[model samples]
Target: MSLRTRLTLLFTAIVSILLALFCGLLYGVAEQYRLREFHARLQAEATTAGHLLLGQERISLNLYKLMDRNQLTVLPDEELIIYNAQNRLVYESGTDYLALTPETLTRIRNEGKVVWREATREIVGILFTDQQRPYIIVASAVDTYGVRTVASLAQLLGIGWCVMTGLMLIAGRFFAGRMLKPISQINQRIDTITATSLSSRLPEGSQGDELTQLARRFNRMLNRLEEAFKLQRSFVSHASHELRTPLTAITGQLEVSLLAEDEPDELRATLRSVLDDVRGLNRMTNGLLELAKASMDASAVPMGPVQLDALLTQIQAKIQQLQPDYTIHLRIDPPDTHASDWQLTGSEALLRTAFFNLLDNGGKFSPDHTVWMQLIRQGTELQVTIHNTGVPIAPDQLPTIFSPFLRGRNANGHTGHGLGLALTERIIQLHQGQIRVDSSAEAGTTFTVSLPG
Candidate 1:
């Protein structure tokens, strides 16, 4: 059933149960009150009959006449009988009177008081003296109109209960709808959002309830999805551009070598150029593959504690072999001491590739300039900052510099596939770390990496 109908039914049931209990209690109390009132009226009539006989000094015929005159108005269902001490019937009232049984009469006479029975209806028999030699035994059936009165009151109360229960149900439905309206609206808005249109949001009402908070949370989720889509688009575009450059170069060099057939020297030179292009293509292809692997691996791979100073020293030695003209400076704060006790907790080969990429970029961009590498520890975090005295990157360009296939404006036709920083970023993120660039036109650029201890 719908929520409104269910709530209404529940309210009706609760009210009905309460009303039934209240009516039952009231019926019991009203029945008792009616019985007490009936008894009081009967006792008053019996007392009056007793007084009339005591004053007359004989079996007064006037007592029966007096009772008959008052019977219809005062006690309609009552019967009067008088018997002498000898147990003989003396005076009687009402035409249909059935005399008390011999056993009942004997009991009343011996007891010398009033007695009652409730067999077919109600019967009461009383005995009294008449100021003469004989006594009186007056037997009467008690009034029973009180039973009808109780039934009528119960019927009236039952009607009132039904009316109150209906009102309660109506009130319950109204409040239930009012309280649930926000949730209903939220559901409708959610229904509007599908795979085709994820931008739709729940309408915010004037009430600052939980529904508003829920809408805000859903909007945040949509925002994250949009960011992921943008990232994916950038990755595809950059990958295509990076791959096409090497393939085009390889194809052009091979075509030129194929066309030159007469001169051996020219042919050998052209074939060597083709060979260089092939090697460059091979290197770019391998870098792209590494970038793709880094992006795809969601699980944190196992890692051993890497000595940062030793790694840097080894990288510097390698760079020196490749480019003997450039000066490389490695500055380690508290030199020879480990900055962090925590392991890198990822693939060491990938980490080395990331660091090598950064170093290569710095060296390739600044041929004759100094490259500075610094490692420092600050409050449970380790930072590695690499500074290169190359051409400065613009503030607008710095943001996209880490994107794949993105090259600085100052690259000046230099050769690069540009997946270097992008791979670095993905690897850092996998380790729960962050990388950022700080640059100035005069001060060159610094790439800082921070990792938690």
Candidate 2:
């Protein structure tokens, strides 16, 4: 069932049950009142009959019977009978509607007074004491007016119950719809949003309810998606341009070599140039793959304890092999350090690549062809600083220096695909580390990395 329908039914059922209980209680009390009031009237009439017939100044049976038959004193199908202490019947109203029994007379003598019902008839028996002797008064009547009154009340209550229940059902449905109207509107608004329409935000209502908070969070998610899309587009554009350069150079050199005179010396030089371009292309492709690996979930990356000092020393040898003209200096703060102090948990290959990028960039940018590397232990953190006494990067470019394929003006002479710094940042982030750079003419440029030890 629909939510609205269920709500309506539940609302109606609760109110109906409460209303039914009230009606039942009211009907029961009304029936009791009717019985009590009618029984009191019968008892009153019976007493009056005893006073007139069994008193010292007793009147004739005919005169008393005549007075008893009057409209005011008589009831519908009423019967009155009196008996002396001897259990003999003295007077009867001549209605013959009720038969006086010996057991009933004995009960009246023993109990003093009693009231009972027979079908629609109500009977009352009382022991009447006169100066002469004790007498018994028995009266029976069918309370036709009172019965009709109570029956009319029951009919009214039943009709009222039906009418009230139906009204409640209608009211329940109307209110339930009102309560759910906002959710319906929200669903409709959500349906209209698509990937292309990510900029379109949800309208937060003034109520400040849970639904409003939900809309606000969803809008924030859309903002992030839009930013990621823009970044991806820029990345693809730069990568295509960078790839086209080397491919074009290789193609041109091959075409020229194929057309030139087949001299061994010329052919070998052209083939060597093409091979260099191919190697550069391969290096860029590997860097792109490493960048992708670094951007994945940290939990998915292989991890183990790596000693920072040993890893940096290994990278130092590799960098020297690649560029024999560059000089790197390694420094450890508080020079005597324990092995455990230099250890941190991370992917060794990724960490190696990240530090290699920083050292290479420093040496490549420095006019003196030298890079300074320092590892300092700070509490549970390991801090590494790579400094170069080269031309400083422009102040404006520092903010986006780590962006993919972004090259600084100082990078004009450097042959690189610009994925190094971006890849390094991602790898550091995967290891729960922070990397930041400071550049100036006085300090040249320095990149700082901090990782948990």
Candidate 3:
């Protein structure tokens, strides 16, 4: 069933049950009042019969019988019976509907008064005394008027209960629809949003309710999606242009060499030029692959404790081996702790690649071919700084320095595909660390990295 229907049924069912209980209670009280009132009337009739038949101021037996015959009775189906102390019947209203027993008479004499029922008839018995002699009076009757009143009340209550239940059901359905109208509007608005219309935002009302919060969250997600789309477009455009350059150079050189039959030395020179271009192309391809790998979800990368001091030492040795003329100085400033303090949680290979790129850049951009590296322990963080004497980067280029395929004016004579810094930044971010760079004429160029220790 739909939510609105279910809500309506549940609301109606609860109120209906309470109403039924109230109607039943009212009927019971009315019935009990009718029975008590009728019993009182029967007792009065019994006392009156006793006084007239057995009291000192007695009425003639023949006169009382005449009065009863002339329609002077107090109740319908009324009967009266009187007995003296000798157990002899003295007077009767002339009715055979009620039969008195020895046990019943004894009870009435001992208790002084008693009342009981037999099917639809109510009976009352009382003790009477005149001149120190005892007598018993019994009266029986059916309450015809009271019974009709109670029956009519029951019929009325049943009809009212049914009518109220139906009205409540209708009211419940109308209110439930009003409560769900906001969600219906939200669904319609969501349908209008598509990939091409990421800028289209949901209307967030001033009401500080949960629905308004939901709309704000959706708008924030759309903002992130739009940013990602722009980055992807830029990445593809830059990669295509970079890849085509070296390939075109190699093709042109070979075509020209084949057209003219040059000497062996000239042909060898042309072939070597082509070989150099191919190597540069291969390096650029490898950088692009590494950059893509670093951009993946951080949870997918395997993690373990890596010693930053040891990883940096390895990078320094590897860089020097590749470029023998480059010089690297490494130093660590420990804070009175154990060797384990240098360890942090991350993917070791990725961290090593990140440090290698930073150290290589420091030496490549410096005039003296020298790079200085330092590690310091500060509270719960480990900070590393790499400094090199070089031409300072322009202030306008700081913001986009880590973006893919972006280079600065100081990078004119450098041999790189401009993917190294971007890959390094991504790897550090995957390890939940931060990397920042500062360059100026007074301090040369320096890169700082911070990681959880």
Candidate 4:
């Protein structure tokens, strides 16, 4: 069932049940009141009959019968009888006369009053005392008018219940539909939000309801999607441009060698040029693959405790071996000589790549071809600082240093695709670490990396 329909049915059922209970309670109370009123009338008739028999001297039975036939002191469907001390019937009025029992007589003599009831009929017996004898007066009746009133009340309650239940159903369905209107709107909006329209945001209402919060979250997700789309477009464009350069160079060189096949020297030079272009393409492809691997979340990357001091020693040796003319001085500091602050959980190869990139960047740019490195323990954190006495990167370009394919304007002779720092950033983020760089002409450039131990 639709939510609105179900809500309406539930409300109708609840109202119907409550109305039934209320009507039942009213009926019971009214029935009791009607019975009490009938009892009072029967009692009054009995008292009057007793008074008449006791007050008058030798009253005639015929006169009492006349009084009843005239309907002066008797009501319809009612009977009043007087019993003598010997349990003999002395007088009676009305129809359906109740036969007095010995048990009833004994009860009247002992208690002064006796009552009996069956279905809608009620009978009351009272013992009356006189100067010469004691007698009993009994009255019995059914309240026909009260019964009719109860039937009318039941009919009215049934009608009221039906009308009220109908009204509740209508109201409940309307309210339920109104409450779900916002969700319906949101669904419609979501339907229109596809990849082509990711820039479009979800509607955020001012009421600050749950629906509003949901819309806000959807809008935020759309923003991220839009950013990813732009980045993917840029990445594909740059990658294609970088790849086409090498292929074009290789093709041009091969065409030149084919056209000038007679000279052995020209053929060798052309092949070497083509080989260099091929090597550049391979290096770019490798860098792109590494960037992709580093971009994954930390949980997706394999992790292990790497000895920071050992890794630094290895990187220092590799850099020294690569650039025999360049000097790379490495220093380590801890609170104690044997402290375990050098150990941290991360991807060792990725971490090594990040450090090697910084070291390479420093050495490549240094006019003196010297890089100074230091690892220091600060509380629960370890910091590695790499300083180069090279040309300083422009101050304005610092913010965009870690952006993909972004290079400093001051970099003139550097041949790089600009993915090193960006890859380093991704790997550091995967390791839950931070990397920052500071550079100036007078003080040179320094790269600092901080990781938790």
Best by lDDT: 2
Ranking by lDDT: 2, 3, 4, 1
lDDT to native, each model: 0.73, 0.91, 0.89, 0.84
> Lowest summed-lDDT stretch of 10 residues in model 4?
333-342
Flag clash pairs in model 4. none
Candidate 1 residue lDDT tens string, 350-423: 77877777787777777465788887776777788888988888778988888877887977678877778888
What overall lDDT, based on C-alpha atoms, would model 4 receive against the true structure? 0.84
What's the true lDDT of residue 275 in model 2?
94
* Model with the higher TM-score, candidate 2 or 3: 3
Off by over 4 Å in 3: 1-169
What's the true lDDT of residue 84 in model 3?
88
Which sections of candidate 2 miss by over 4 Å? 1-192, 304-345, 369-383, 450-453
lDDT of 4 by residue, 185-294 (tens): 88898898888888777779899989899889888988888988988888888788888988998998788777765588777878888888888888888899999999
List CA RMSD, all candidates. 7.7, 6.0, 5.5, 5.4
Between prediction 2 and prediction 4, which has the larger TM-score?
4
Per-residue lDDT of 197 in model 1: 73
**Which is better, 1 or 3, measured by lDDT?**
3
Clashes of each: 0, 0, 0, 0
Write the number of the candidate with greater lDDT, choosing between 1 and 2: 2
